[model samples]
Target: MATTVRRAVLTLPAAPLGPENPLPPLAAPGDVHRPAVPRARDGEELPPAMARRMTWAPLRSLLPVRRRDAYGRHRQRTDLDALVVENDRLRATVLPGLGGRVHSLFHKPSGRELLYSNPVFQPAGFALNGAWFSGGIEWNIGATGHTTLSVAPLHAARVPAPDGGEMLRLWEWERLRDLPFQVDLWLPDGSDFLYVGVRVRNPHHHTAPVYWWSNTAVPEAPGSRVLAPATGAFHFGYERALRRVPVPVWDGADRTYPLNGQRPADYFYDLPDGERRWIASLDAHGHGLAQTSTDLLTGRKLFLWGSGPSGRRWQEWLTEPGTGGYAEIQAGLAPTQLEHVPLHPGGEFAWLEAYGPLAADPARVHGEDWAAACAEAAGRLEAALPRATVDAAYAAWRPYADHEPKETLAAGSGWGALEVERGRLELPGTPFAEGTLGEEQRPWRELLRHGVLREEGPEPGPSLVSAPWRELLESAGPGPYTAYHLGVAQWHAGDRSQAVRSWEQALRYGCAWPALRCLGAADRLDGHPERAADRYAAAVAEARHARVAHPTATALAREAVEALLEAGRAEEADALLAGVHPTARSHGRFRLLRARVLLARGDAAAARAVFDEGFDVDDLREGERALEDVWFAVAERLVAGDGPVTEEVRDRARAEHPLPVRYDFRMGA
Candidate 1:
């Protein structure tokens, strides 16, 4: 451990640049529920029990916050409280006041910034939630996009290191998720690499999907090139469609070249199947960043807005024009945000990623060349320090996590400790004017156009059919995601047979689990329960075969069990539910299906027990809650022989739990 020197606050002459555009104040992020308003069944509004299930969204304040003033300026300015740390080989600056982001990372040896440092603190309304700021490796955890705490302050400490090195730790208790995360960024004395270790803990007895992607932004200019270890990848597009393409070579154009044309594309590509790690970008002179984790499981993602007019408009929209647009080299834990791994109750997730600068002559030009470079690069990094020194440094790391720490920022202020701490930096957030609503259109459109699963709805277009166009989308080498949407377009056009055929082709092209799940939903909606069950089963199989089981896959398995129960096939339902993970088995839907199965087998007492016992309904949405209530009500009526579920019982249950037509991840599903 390094000695703790006398702490001194220094006033700097120059300030970091502020965002060109301030984030518009956000209203709490929640689904835009198009609820079929509660109808009056009786003269007395169904006597409360028949009332509709509520749309109780979690408090929005808990998500990442970007308070806006009357002119839409981000309340927390980026110029102040800019904490700086450095070593012999590298230097890092942290903006504690600006969401605690590592604002800049410069390699002293190469005099190059390994990470992009936006001159302006620009935030985009692009997150799955509402607020997102670009630049640096922003820690995105909780749901898929930006975390609630992304913009808020994180409790920060510049921990002392005995060896004259720097170890600054940032920790926070995520209020909405009931989880705590700690990120320790260590720059050892004389070391070339910056070590980032993140630990997330879920202490609740309920399971939920946890998301994280270390978003690294690097300068994308005329001389830059990308390198990853894969031949081909699953490319997710700007229109929220999918396709498979050879890595760094899409439409036969080498994507590694920074100038890959102006027909803008946005995609998250899955690298080749094997034990691989590292995703890098280097300029023509071979100077940039190479990042990797302790484990080899990482996805290489590229976000390139075309050089075209609309694309440039978006580039400036996100930041500012003339500042020059940059591309993203994201290292993710999952292929797509839709298929994140589920974190079990009381489970812990930990990972270590290293960001180091690299330079090579004639630099890597393709995926194959890059993979070879990574192997040598990894060895060189490991050889930087003694084995014991590296091992002891990490092993001695202590954790600081709290879910209910003492509140600061003055009583009733509602700002968190980090926010208060951020205030100490001198740049303060301005309060919004009364009745001011956050600008949500940009975020909503961003999701609709680029996001999968959690978007608002299908991109607006004719919901009717065009046979000739359908054949073209299906046959013109469209990616799986593109094909799936094509099938959807066909289905809306009154071509069910063609839709199925189109979807199956994408399934065969390695679209994996999502395709099968989509088919299952369609079949079930079409009243083909047995066929849907088959599709769900196949989808579940694919999910299980992945390095880790996916959330939607298990959710689909629970759905399949429901289908079997609906078909009065108790044994089939029982067998399938048995194979699901315990956490999934505890889902309210699965338990209700089990209860239904028991009732079908004449086990009234057992069925009642399933309902009487507590159901883990903590993380479920309105629909799931409604389904649970309805099932329990039905079961109670059947068990008590209460004269065919009287209108009173039906009304009460329906009122308590009015499920949407479908409860799923899909927009509007």
Candidate 2:
């Protein structure tokens, strides 16, 4: 014989029978026409008159059916009696609202049919619901009104697996009190994967509300790539952009965006537009997962990935201001900031996004047609179109690199940081003015137009010369060349005190030719002949170290030789120029300096020979240009005068040269 299973039954107190009840009316037709009577309220019992007034009226008369009981005896009762008796038994044994209402019922003996129903709403705005199956378990759902603006629902179900194991489901919901929001979650069918979501709506005017962010965990194996479209490259905050890592500029290239390579503490605020519309895929060996977020309204895409265990705990939430207040949108690994959108009043935002598993062969991945298609798509979305706006904004934030200034001698307060011929010049930590001078090369061609630096000014003076230089220098940061130029400028301004101070500071920081000239000039002015010689020697040494053609260094050496000769140190000055061959010897100033040095040693023949070799008969008749004239006059006195070249001859030489010749090192050969 086969054994049959049965459910245990419990009995309870009977409910007060009345004609007004649907059960009694179904059982007796005469009970349909009933005289209603007022019920007792709070501590009051029903009066006999009221009870008698509630008696049923005979609206219709019908005979009851006769049926055979288990004992084979005749029972005077109809099918309606059987229904009423079963209903009474149900009412007596099970409470009406204990297991909630029957939302939907299915008689799925074969377990192939699926049925669902909308949740029920009760009169007091509370609903109790359940689903049951024959020979199976029952699921119940209930709700309770907590306050005027809050309500909570509870759900209970028994989930059966194909393996005969059963799981119990228990979940709760709490509607926000006095807020236009509700949160709910469920362990549907008692599965480990929980379905969670939140709905937020505002009935009044639109306003920005603060939403709390939740920790989202992602799990995966190693070798997963997270792809996203960034405005530029990811900043680790340790170094400047583009220079920090090996990322190419906004031009389309195959360089890594440096997203996954960043440290955990690093955060990206405004990503480049190209990188924003990215899709990141995390793959482990061959098995991998891909997630893409698409804005339903704008159709913008954001791609993300995860790996190594944390991927499983990943969740997405939309929240309001309160503890434990949020709506869980996604329950698996998902990219953050996927669909950041503002919700407007009476506006609905929906996203059409997906997550799926993929298998890729590592050897063939890069060459695969599918991989090519993905890359092409990514390039089209992020790499093809130029993000001019984003690039412009980023460019605005980047530090500028201006050209080195040209002449620092003519320091003017109105001079700008940039100029056409000269690049830029300003005191350290001071702002670049309207007009300045700078180097010959176009340094900022990559940033602006190549000819922008060459534009002429409206008028003459500092404004005409300094404007371009100021523009270029204002864009640049502190550099060695800039400091050197500034020191020279200080020296030329006749502020020898300040000039020496600035040059010393520059040397302490870094030694350059301009700084050396300032040092030498300051030493000569301060009567420190030894220090001036040392500065000139240092300049030559640095020039050799740099191994480049530096006119400034050569000029400083020449000046040092003259100063030594003035101090009656002819042998020392000659020794300084031992290996240094004079280039551009045809220049009038070069011959003049050589002539002066030769005359100082009383070698009148050699001095006259230098003038003869360098100057033409007409050039000599031209009365010498400034410095050359002074030296030529001294030579005339040495050769034509009978005795030593006296103070009167020196005064004539000084008048010819005009004291300072304004040596320009920037002049071309």
Candidate 3:
């Protein structure tokens, strides 16, 4: 019954995570929720402390957007590399190549899968950079959205555990925050619980905003209740507001059951200062999973996709149509996902989390009294796995945190190796060796070592915008290539004027259409939509004339059409879209754009027909309502005659043209 760690392969039907978008993510996709709460709402307001530390603004920068939208919906049987850590009582399956996600945790005695084990490896548009799938225990770091490493590989290795058994260690330098982090997972020789040790290190000389959330997905079932040690919670819904509401029941429904509401929502439980932080999801039979962590991880949240059509549709879209729904019970360093904790210079945050089964009294867990229900689950959790044991585990794991990895298991991005080489980082156990550096880091290495950025290909492969990289780019002499990168760095640093100047200079120096597209993004951000459209159109024309790759041409055309439509030039948008490659025309994104143009040009029938044709944007983002909005907009135009469509017309359109399930990917109420 000894613990063992070994490498294995998981063959699932997986959609290939296509190449990263070559374009610099000059503009954020603008999908994050920055909820603005009202001062007066029946004596409800965000706690003053929560409101003050809510944003990581002035420090948060998303400069190098490595777009992962190139993945298509076609999933083939694929062999995913994995690492398995198992003991007598439980087995943990980790996907080393996929952000070090814990793909499955199986309890041997009960023959139960504690985590929501996704049946397939489908990449959806959920991550901050794109391409995210539902289910599993996902480690989210680097700002408010899903981590940029959602589907990216992480360096995995075998390390010695405190228990004398080998532990699986996963480490990577988070690009967004420019910090190194590691996760060590081990199961003791004779334990039902799987232990995880997480550490995020800010090796920089200045303060860095650090966000970490261990998101666990559990199967959603009838009578399932999420129990936490808090009565009141901060509720955030699609209305884009955070309101303090009572737990268990709010807005005349018992929301802890996951299926009680008709919309997707988050309940960030307000845990007491000294309370043992833990959360559990118990099913109808009173048997379920519980997660507990050291005091360093304070936040607990319940994210549910309720029984509404939109929520159901989103659930189906994330996986197969007939799969059971799941809800996320998460723990983070901050009280809510909206906040980011500041890790001081040369500081680190570490914690230990344990996951296993808990069998509680069903009647008490489902009772009317919220306190009694929580106490019931909490008591059972304590009896099963005491808080002191978790603390001791953390203490034991800390010393081994710096132990050199015994054997390499997988490879991650070489950005860390590049950073380590540039900065002379002395990290011990989590090494970013020079051998990990690849083609992506070549130009940066050249700039770092030789002081000049070399032109790699037709387009710049990626972007680096952190202050250090910016300093390096700034030091690199002024050329078309250097200027383009400097523009991106300047833009991320909030130097809009200088960024624009640099981009313009790059274009003048014969830089490719990337500069023009970046300029287009800047114009849109500066509130000149028409100017943005012009820049985008110009970029598209230049790309075609230059005989750029068909994908690049299509990408440029997509941006142009979007900007043109946003500028209220539907005819121009349609004309521009029509001239793109046939693959672009058939793309789900373009089809939706065409529908928008048809509605704008006063052709509701044509717009509706596009919906009937049925297309899927493989990378349709989480919480994106563009498709649903357009469908209803076209419906309103079809139902309402001439003048402005009033509320009455809107209601009629909703009733008459109910959103088709195929297109209902709305994440809100």
| C-alpha lDDT values of all predictions | 0.53, 0.30, 0.87
Winning model by TM-score: 3
**What C-alpha lDDT, on a 0 to 100 scale, does residue 501 get in candidate 2?**
66
- Better candidate by lDDT, 1 or 3: 3
Candidate 1, residue 68: CA error in Å? Answer: 6.3
Candidate 1 — worst ten consecutive residues by lDDT sum? Answer: 404-413
Superposition TM-score, candidate 1 onto the true structure: 0.50
The full ranking of all candidates by lDDT, starting with the best, is 3, 1, 2
Q: Give the least accurate 10-residue stretch of model 2, judged by summed lDDT.
A: 80-89
lDDT of 3 by residue, 1-669 (tens): 656899899999888787777677776555445565433145565666666667455233455657787888778999989999999999999998899999999999999999999998888888888889888999999888689899999999999999999899999999888999999999988888999999999989999888899999999988999999998888887767777888878889998999997899889999999999999999998889999999999999999999998898888877887899999999999898888788999999999999999999999999998899999999999998899999998999999999999899999989999989988999988999899999888988999989998875567678888888899888887789899999999998889999999999999988868899999988987899999998998888878777877667777787788899889999999899889778758879888988999998999999899989889877788778888789889989988867689999999999999987788777775
Predicted candidate 2 versus true structure: per-residue lDDT over 1-669, tens digit per residue: 111111122232211111110000001121111222223223234334423332322211111111110011112222110000011001101111222111222122222111111121111111110111111111211111011111112222222211232222222211111013221112222121211122333332443221211111123223433333333232221121111222222234222222332121122223333343323333334333332333221221211221111111111101111212111112111111111223455432222222223334544333324445345435433332223422332232122111122212112212123321133222221223334323322243321344232222211011111223334433545444444434443433334576466557657756454467557656766678877777766766666666534333344456767667756777666666553555523344445666766767667677766755644210111112334454456555654466666777776655553322222111110
Model 2: residues with Cα > 4 Å off, grouped in runs: 1-479, 489-496, 524-530, 550-554, 614-669
Cα-based lDDT at residue 356, candidate 3 = 95
lDDT of 1 by residue, 8-38 (tens): 2323322222222121112233422211333
Candidate 3 RMSD to the real structure? 1.9
Cα error, candidate 3, residue 231 (Å): 1.5
